[model samples]
Target: MSLGKKLKQLRKEYKYSQAVVARDIEVSQQAYSFYENDKKKPTMPVIARLARLYQIPMSELLNAEENTKEQQMEKFIEVLTRRIWAIIDLKYLNNNFFDLCLVIEEQARISLMSVQSREILEKKEFDLDYTTLGKLRGDYLEPFKEEIENKNQDTELIPNLVETIFLKEKEIASKYFE
Candidate 1:
C-alpha cells in the first residue's frame, strides 16, 4: 500500500487524530489528510517522523500483515500465559491457606504431573537439603503443633498428643523418601 495508508493505519491503531499526527510531523492537517486519503505524498523526512511517532518500523507499517503465523503464535502465547495466571489467582483466592502453602503446593503439583518423584529428585537435581524447604514442610504438614503446645490439658493427655505429633512427623518424613 501507499505511505498514506500505512500512516493512517498507524494513526488509527493508536487512536491518534490526523491533526495530532500532522502537528507532530510539522505538516498541515490538510496535507496529512491528503496523505491518508492517497491524494498527496509525504516528503521523506515527514515519512521518517511519522514512522518514529508511531513507534513502528517503517517496513512493518508499509508491509503490514494482519495475521502472520509468527504474530499469531506470539498472541497465542500471550493469551495462554494470561489464562494460566488467572487460574492460579483463582486457586489462591479460593483457598484460605494461600500464603506459603499454595505457591509451593502448586509448583509441586505441576512437577508431579509432568514427572515422577524419582525423576524430579534425581534427574532434575532438585535440592532436598534446603532449609526453607524444611520450614515449609513443617508449616504445611505440622499444622497442629502450636495448638498441641498451647493446650490447657490434663497430664493424662500429654502422651496421646505426643504420639499424634510423632506419627504425623513420621508420615511427613516418609513422603520425602517416596
Candidate 2:
C-alpha cells in the first residue's frame, strides 16, 4: 500500500474523478496523476489537504513500507556515487597513475552495472552473467595492461590511456541511454 495506492483507493471510495480531486486539492490534473503514479511526492501542505479531504490522518496517507524501501535505495545510491567520486577525485597517489586509472576504471564499471533500471533489465533479453562493462574491461583494459607490461610502463602514455578509457565509457553509456 503505497501513498499512490491509498490515494487511488480513497478516490474510488468517494467516486470522484481525477479532475474533481485535483480541483479540490488546488492542483492540475496532470500533477494529481503524477501523485497517483508515484512519480512525484506531494508536499506536506498537499498531504494535509488530502488528509482533510479524505477524512484521514496525514500519517495514514503515507505508506511506511514504501518509505523504508525508498530510504534504503537512497542510501545505496549515495554510497555508490561517493565511492566513484572518491576514486576520481584522488589528488595524491604516490606517482602511481597506472594503479589509479585501473581503480577508477573498475569503480566506473561497477557503477554502470549497479545503476541500471530494474524495469529495463527485466524487459531486455540477454544473459544475466554478461555485462557491457565486463566486455569493455576485456576489450580495452586487458590489452592496455599487457602493452604497459611489455613496454615497461611509459609515463607519457598514461594521459592518453585515461582519455581513451573515458571516451569508450561515454560511447557505451550514450548508446544505452539514447
Candidate 3:
C-alpha cells in the first residue's frame, strides 16, 4: 500500500482523529489530513517522527520494500549520501554536535545494506577483504559507526534532533500534501 493509505489505516486502527495525531506531532489537523490523503510526502524527519509515534521502524513508515542487491545498494547510497550532506549542512549551521551523531546513526543503518550486498556478491562463503568491504561501506559509514558509539549517553540530545528536524520537515511535507 502507499504510505498515505497505510498511515490512514494505522490511524483508524489506533482510533486517532487527524487533529489528535497532528497535535501529538505538533502539526495542524489539515496537515495531518493532507498526509493521509498522500497529497504530500513527509521529509525524512517527519517520517522518522511518524515511525516513532506509530511505534514502528522508519522503513515501515516509508512503506519501503526489500529489494534485490542492486536496488538495495541504490537506496542505501541515496539515504547515506543525503545523510552525509545533512551532516555537512548541520556543521555549517552550527547546529548541536548531536545533530552530526544522529546523521551518523542514520548513515550506519543505511550501511547495513552493504553487508547484505556483500553476501549476495560472494554467493555463500563470503571472503571479502576489510578494505574492499570498507570501500563498499562508503566513506561516511565508518565515521558514523564510530561516532554512534562515541556519542554521549548523558546528553539525550540526539533523539531530540530527530524531533527538531521533523518540525522543520512538517512545513515541507505540508507543501507536498497540498
Candidate 4:
C-alpha cells in the first residue's frame, strides 16, 4: 500500500480523527489531512512523532516494503501461531490498551479533534469523521482481538506490528511499572 493509504489505515485501526493525529504530531489538522490524502508528505520529525504516537516503527509507518530483508528480520517479525502465542493470548484475554490510554492520556500525546478543527473541516467540506472518537476507544478494541490473533494464514512474518501496538502500549504505561 502507498504511505498515505497505510497512514489512513493505521489511523482508522487506532480510531483517530485527523485533528487528533495532527495534535499529537503538533501539526495543523489541515496538514495532517493533506498527509493522509497524499497532497503532501510529512516532514521527518512529524513522521517520527506519528510513528511514536501510533506505536509503530518508522519503516512500517512509511511502508518501506523495498526493505524486504529488513522487514523479514527475525526479531521484529514472527509467525502468528508460534512462540509469540503468549503475547497473542495475553492481548486476547486482556484488552487493556484503552485503559492504558485513559491512564496516561494527560501526559501522553493525543489526536482527537477539537471543536475548532471540526469547524475547519466542515468549512473545507472534507468528509472525515471527527465525532464518536471518545466513544470508539474501548468499543473498537474488542472486535480486533480475534482477527489479529488469527491473521496467520500465509504464515509470513509481519514486520513491526508490535511497534505499532504492543511495545508502544507498554511504553506508554511504563510509568506504572515497578
Candidate 5:
C-alpha cells in the first residue's frame, strides 16, 4: 500500500468522496486524485491535514509502504483486534469476564468488508466471515487474553502480544489468500 492507496482506503472507510476530501484538505480535486492515483505526493501540510481528517496519527499516514494486500490485511486485522481488546479491557475494568465476552460477541456483528468493498453487499474481494473470525479468536485472541491475564496488565508486554498475534494471524491468513 502506497500512501495514495492508504489515502484512498481511509477516504472510503470514512465514506468521503474524493471531492469531499479535496475540499476538506484544501486541495483541488484533480490534485487529490493525483495523490490517490500515486501520480503525485502530497506536501507535509497536506499530509498533516489528511492525518487530521482521518483522525489518525501523522506517523501512520506518512509511514505507508508498498506491501502486498495480504500483508496489509493481516496488519489491519492485528491492529483492529488489539484495539478491540484494549477497548474491552477498559470497558470491563471491574474484571467481569462474562460481560467482556458478551461485549465481544456483540462486536462480532461487525462486518470486515466495510474496509474492502466498493459497494456494500454487492461486491467483496475479500471478507472476514464468521468461520475465519472464529479461527482468529480461538487461535490468537484467546491465547492473548490468557497471556494478558497472566502478565497482570503490564504495558511492556504489549509488543510481545502484538508480535504473537501478528504471527498467528499471518499463519491463519495464509489460507485466506490461497
Candidate 6:
C-alpha cells in the first residue's frame, strides 16, 4: 500500500469525496487529486490541515502505509483502551488503580515495540539493535512510572513525562536512521 492508496482508502472510509476533502483542507480539487494520485506531495501545512479535517493524528496520515499491521493493531488497541478508561472514569480508583494503570502501560509499550520490531524486520530486511530497542523501551516506559508517581505523590509530572518521551523517541529515531 502506497501513501496515495492509503489516502484514498481513508477518504473512502470517511465517506469523503475529493472535492469535499479539498474544500475542508483548503486545497484546490486538482491539487488534492494530485495528492491522491501520488503525482505530488502536499506541503506540511496541508498535511496538518488534512489530518485535522479528518480528525486523525498527523502521524496516522503521514505514515499510514509505512505502519505494519501489527503496529496498526497495537495502536488501535491502545486507543480503544484509553477511550474505554476515559469513558468509565477509571482515574478515580485508589492506589491499586495506579498499579493497574502502570501494568497496562507497560504491556502497551511491549506490544508496540514487538509490533515495530516485527515490521522493521519483515519489511526492511534488517536486524534492529536489541540494545537500542531496550534503551528506547526504557525511555518509553518512564512516562508510565512518572504518571504513577505523580498520582501517588500528588505532583504535576505530566509535562516532564511528555518531554522525556519525546527526547527518548528522538534518540531512538536517530539510532534507527544511523
Which model scores highest in TM-score?
5
For model 5, the local distance difference test gives 0.61
Per-residue lDDT tens digits for candidate 4, residues 57-156, read 8977666324343332221223211323444345432444454334323212222121012343455432322222323333434444344445342212
For 2-77, candidate 3 gives per-residue lDDT tens digits of: 5676677557546788888888877778887888888978778778778888787887776543433454344345
Cα lDDT over the full model 3 = 0.51
Across 1-178, the per-residue lDDT of candidate 6 in tens digits comes to 4566657756764678999999988999999999988898888999899888768788877886677665555453544355334422444234243444444444444433432433444454333444335545554655565454345554233345334433443443333232
Each prediction's TM-score versus the true structure: 0.37, 0.37, 0.36, 0.39, 0.48, 0.41
Candidate 3 stretches greater than 4 Å from native? 64-178
Against the true structure, candidate 5 reaches a TM-score of 0.48
Q: Give the TM-score comparing model 3 with the true structure, all chains together.
A: 0.36
- Which ranges in model 6 have alpha carbons more than 4 Å from their true place? 74-178
Superior candidate under TM-score, 1 versus 3: 1
Local accuracy of candidate 1 as per-residue lDDT tens digits, 1-178: 3455556655754678989999999999999999888898777788778879966566554454343445433333333344334544443334333332444344443332222223434543345433245566456435544433343433234344334423333343333334
Candidate numbers sorted by lDDT from highest down: 5, 2, 6, 3, 1, 4
Query: What is candidate 4's CA lDDT for residue 67?
Result: 35
Q: Show where candidate 4 strays beyond 4 Å.
A: 64-178
Instruction: Quantify all predictions' global Cα lDDT against the true fold.
Output: 0.50, 0.59, 0.51, 0.49, 0.61, 0.56
Q: In candidate 5, how many Å is residue 127 off? A: 6.6
State which candidate, 3 or 6, has the greater lDDT: 6
- Model 2, position 117: C-alpha lDDT score: 39
Between 5 and 6, whose TM-score is larger? 5
Kindly indicate the candidate among 1 and 5 with the higher TM-score: 5
